[model samples]
Target: MARSKGQTALNRAQIVETGLRLLNEVGLDGLTLRRVAKELNVQAPALYWHVGNKQELLDEMATAMLREMSGGQGSDPPGSNWQELLAQAGRGLRRALLRYRDGAKVFAGTRLTDTGHAEEQEAHLRRLVAAGFSPDAAARASFIVFVFTEGFVIEQQAVHPMPGERAPGYDVTERAEALGPEFPLAAQAGADLFGDYDARFEEGLSAVIAGIGATLGPRTQS
Candidate 1:
């Protein structure tokens, strides 16, 4: 149903939600302002009030998606260890992103943004800094976690998607299989790719957490 002016007061949050829905249905390239407006039942011009343009809208959606993934973990306890807390936040964000189709792509470069994801990163940054990390180290460490999580998600999504009837196009798997025994590693992992993401994500995450922990200096005596 088309909304009246009284109901047309959609904010950026609503706009980003609409964008995410469109992305899931039509995907990135097929997504457009017209599509979003049609889904929202508003004129395209109305979106400009929230998103400015398509690139801005993409950036907004990316930020919004990452922010949505950042929650469900309760607040850090007072005086809790910082390394564990940081890993918790990173895993929370990655798990949230995994719930949606093509979620990683939707979240690219969001940490560098001032939008929703940046707000989440700021929270992580605060905890790290308070734990005696320098601002630069805090920033660098947060970024390492972000890159690993997002990169892992991207690979997982590409090499794996939900079981469904594939649409007509180049059969990617056919080409991959045709590469033959020369690509022994790829062939061996081919079947393994169908395994549980939760297991792999956790496995990868544990290593990341361990790596970060190894680099930490002993606590300073106040």
Candidate 2:
């Protein structure tokens, strides 16, 4: 497959941007290098110059999403404590993952293509260390918060799927009814479990941060 005539103008950034736009339209399953190439009006072979395969493209897209979340800079505001920094990072990450359809899925397992995230992580870990967490503890604490945020968004997307759209079978009333009268507590819990995502996320994040502080804080160290 020969390169497209305009392939010279194509770059990795443009490919990633186009891939992200198409992701919202067709979703991760539907997105493909060929589809992206078509959107960019370039030959499929042209994309290989920037991304060798679909996974590579997805990795790039994921990295781009993170960059957008951080605004291409360290996100910590001045004077923020470690807990505040972790919470802010969690909230910012959730917002970023919610921006595109299946954004969480896109970001979950892919490797980033650049070092920008490394810089942010280094700063985050350093802050945690300065706050008296051992390096290993800091890494674990940060990872716990990160995974909590990622998992929350994954489930949120599963329930909502798309803006103004609720996936079938998640209706609180119907869910409660299906559980029947025998399971009163489980049925009643459906409403809280399935709805109030924003509040639930904040509550969950707070708990995670608190748990880290309790277990990994300076005072907890032996």
Candidate 3:
């Protein structure tokens, strides 16, 4: 089959968008350049022209997801303090990851293909610096916050797998029963550990932010 003259030329953005949709439908393991190409009615080699390989396509998808999360502008809300800013970023990132199947796994360890996020990242570091953190400390603290959110979401997706869905073997009640009466504390802790993700994330994010502040010391007047 030949592409018609009216057909729009393929681009990186189109490929990434298609890949994300496929990710939701088939998950990270099922998503492939060939599938994306088929979705776009193009040959697999055509996708390679825009994305060198599957990993490159995944990187592009992650970048696109983050871009969408930031609404194409990564700035903290007005008057947001460093702690507030850190918490907001964590929450936002988690929401973004939850938007796709295996999102955290796909996003983790992938390099951004472009510098679009650099300015926003710089702004975050600058804000922290103004809050009295040394440049290195600011970077480290920011990374810690990010890593915590990523790790949390990875575990979250593993248990939930998808929205309104739960993987087998993770049921709190079943887990408690499986542990039997001997492991009372462990059985009782199931609800606290596995239930109420929103609350857990907020609590964990708050604790992380507090720890960062405590470890980094008092913030100077900006």
> Per-residue lDDT for 1-222 in model 2, tens only?
555555658889999999999998898899999999999888798899889999999999999999898784455788888889788889889989999999999999999888877777888899889888899998999889889999998999889877787878899999888999999999999889889899999999999999998887667445
Q: Model 1, residue 9: what's the lDDT?
A: 72
Using TM-score as the measure, which candidate wins?
Answer: 3
For model 1, residues 1-222, the per-residue Cα lDDT tens digits are 355867657678888888888776776678888899888878888888888877788888776665566546667667777767766766787776666666777677543245545565688788888887778877777777878888887776665432342334325466557768799777667455645667887787778767765675224744
Best by lDDT: 2
Task: Kindly report which residue stretches of model 1 are placed more than 4 angstroms away from their true locations once superposed.
Answer: 1-11, 77-80, 110-123, 129-132, 160-177, 216-222
lDDT of 1 at 60: 80
Per-prediction TM-score, please? 0.74, 0.90, 0.91
lDDT of 3 by residue, 46-105 (tens): 777779999998889888888888784356778888889788889889989999999999
TM-score of model number 2: 0.90
Comparing 1 with 2 on lDDT, the higher-scoring candidate is 2
lDDT, model 1, position 203: 80
Report how far residue 95 has shifted in candidate 1, in Å: 1.9
